[model samples]
Target: MATLSPEMPKSDDRKSSKDVVAKLNYVGEMHDRAVYDIRNPAGSNIVWDTRDVTIHDVRPHLDKFTMDTQGFAFVKLPSKFAENPELFEGNRKARHFVTDDSLDVQYAQEICDYIQNMTGARDVFPRLGGLVMRTSTRASAEKAAWAPPAEFVHLDFAPQAMQGWIDKTLAAKPRDLKPYSRVQLFQAWRCISPGPQDNTLAICDGDTVSSDDKVIVDSMTGDPSIPGNRWDSRMCHYSPDHRWYYMPDMEPDDLVLFKGYDSDVPDAMNAMHSAFQNPLGQTGVPRKSIEARILAFYD
Candidate 1:
């Protein structure tokens, strides 16, 4: 039931202005229903371009993933950008981040016996982060895993900061491994959301807008050969301004929900990347030697 557009000849011109906003709203807001209806069902789903995507249909998926006294929900929308929907192919760098929280996650039944009857998101899930990695063509897996010179080292950040910290790690990584940005990693690990804060509202990314084109999901070709193409959902992933906690995986109907992370390098991420290739490190450079150089420069 989605709105469709006069088709564009190529991928670049495919989306209209409303398409962009719809994609954004989807990534930001759609995933909150798990908390809103922890004990019930979502009123509507924005997919099908007409908001035809409904929570009632998703209930079965929730029933499958829910755990004892808790569960999780996921809303998959179309990609915001049409250039490419698959983020899984390439030499990828992936990590997890819990940037913000949604209001429902805060007041839900998982938290406190004292704080209303709803469960607190923090108690049900805490420090949840996603596992993400860029992808490469089927061919790249054979490359001897890209490695940095002896001077650099690899370290995992606290789960919540993995995505943010990845920028730091990459800048420090060798130029040979730069392609890691393209691959998108899949994270089904467990975790919970941090409590709600001033920025509790979440953001979303969607492929098409309900108001834009009524026929958004329809295809002229009807190419059954195209594996992921026939569907109307957008391929991109992103979340809102709310902060979240990175944790391992949990069960269904639990108020904890999930959405995709915004894929971009932040400032903290860039700084980390900068340190990777500083002049101080080379083939024979001792780890301590390079660390000393970086320390001196920063000091």
Candidate 2:
């Protein structure tokens, strides 16, 4: 059973303190299992539960959060779109992402290069299919066929699922794959919208989460008729020990990189994150964001 925190901040402190109090959805204990249908939420049948918790602003403690320690890191990475917004304006649309355009391909390569430089990896592979745009509003999400900001606390992939991805990726290569000393999967997220986002992502400190706290759930995406649309992800049961942090009023240039799996380290930190409503209340601009998955190999 998950223990509830007795030190939950008061309503006044939540608004005035450095930390913000917000509601985060987690897997309910009532259900022995759960399944999330990403394409069709109406078809999802499971318990959806929420809890009010304090989320600390990470800016002041940026040095403490690193991929090697807390499983996530925040950095200032200027995008080419920022330098010349007009040139790549069309690339923002979901339709352009359907078939990789030259602009999209360039942007993807930029991300790959950045990751390789940051991690000092032998190589970095960007999963083009993993690139996605999300919005906080329903209308934008529906219009673009883009996913909404996920409101639940969960990690992207389980260990077995990550291994499966590694296998498939290697098998598709034209040449034989070489053995690697280490492998790490990462998700890079950035807010494309304006600052003071009404909804921002909150990540739990990996060190605070216990193995038993995670519950494997099926994530179903794409067409229901497809056979390979499902994969295993991890959802959490509430634990008072969980420490959550978020970057408040993030700008377009700010990028967050979090790890999903690590092959070398035992009990490696895996960032568990969710989008939460801002305790300070809504801003004029809703949250618009993009995320990509990248795999890094170290020899």
Candidate 3:
């Protein structure tokens, strides 16, 4: 990691020692006793209702970890999608699919191209990534396409799940893909809401995370029509070496690019992240964001 001090220093507004409660998944031994249940499967809200869990007051030691050294980076994009905030509204589902002709879809494709350029990948394939809104208010929250801030520190894909997704996605496409030795998965996330967030994301530096720190868990999407099974994801335990950081007061224009999975790099494939409560956050405003997952192919 390069020297984080010369770049920027902690301020009174963004304190260094500040700690917030972060709910994380249980360690391996406790998993045997943990409960696994789908709460609102019909409503697309499925999670582990495990009683055995760890809720820790974690302090984001940002001075140590950063994007260049870690598996995450920040991008400044004064996007066209931010202009019309009402584009995503009044949807019961968690995500609304973007059409090919829609302006939102066009903006999303721009992000895909940005990732491809950054990674120097031959081709980038985009999934149906859409709007995700979160609010503290009951009425507005109920009507909107909402997802609670992910409490657990986890990666979106495990080995098997990623391979399955690749196989399934490629099989559906009409043309045969060119031979590629490496595949990388990335997520481009941006907060489309107006102000500062109370529940913000915290990312762990990939270099510090060890192999034994991760535990794979099944992500049940609640769609029973599909043949065999749910997606596989990873959950993590607290490690002394784990270095965490967060971008304070993120706005509509700011974008965060992070790694979900990378086949070429084994030691630091998935960048572990979760939304943590900000102790110094403003009142009333909730977090509303959009995230797109893209697959990058390298020959």
| Residue-by-residue lDDT tens digits, candidate 3, 47-82 | 432222222222244334454457776556667765
Residue-by-residue lDDT tens digits, candidate 2, 145-186: 246778999997887787667765555443354788888888
Highest TM-score scorer: 2
Q: What TM-score, over all chains together, does every model reach?
A: 0.18, 0.83, 0.76
What Cα-based lDDT does every candidate model obtain?
0.20, 0.70, 0.60
For residues 198-275, what per-residue lDDT tens digits would candidate 1 score against the true structure? 011111111211212111111111233533112221211221221112111112112223222222311111010001
Alpha-carbon runs more than 4 Å astray in model 1: 1-57, 61-166, 172-181, 185-299
Quality of model 2 by C-alpha lDDT: 0.70
As for candidate 3, its clashing pairs are none
**After superposition, which runs of candidate 3 have C-alpha atoms over 4 Å from their true positions?**
1-28, 31-69, 90-97, 128-143, 171-176, 227-229, 266-269, 282-284
| RMSD (CA, Å), each prediction | 24.6, 7.1, 5.2
Per-residue error (Å), model 1, residue 19: 27
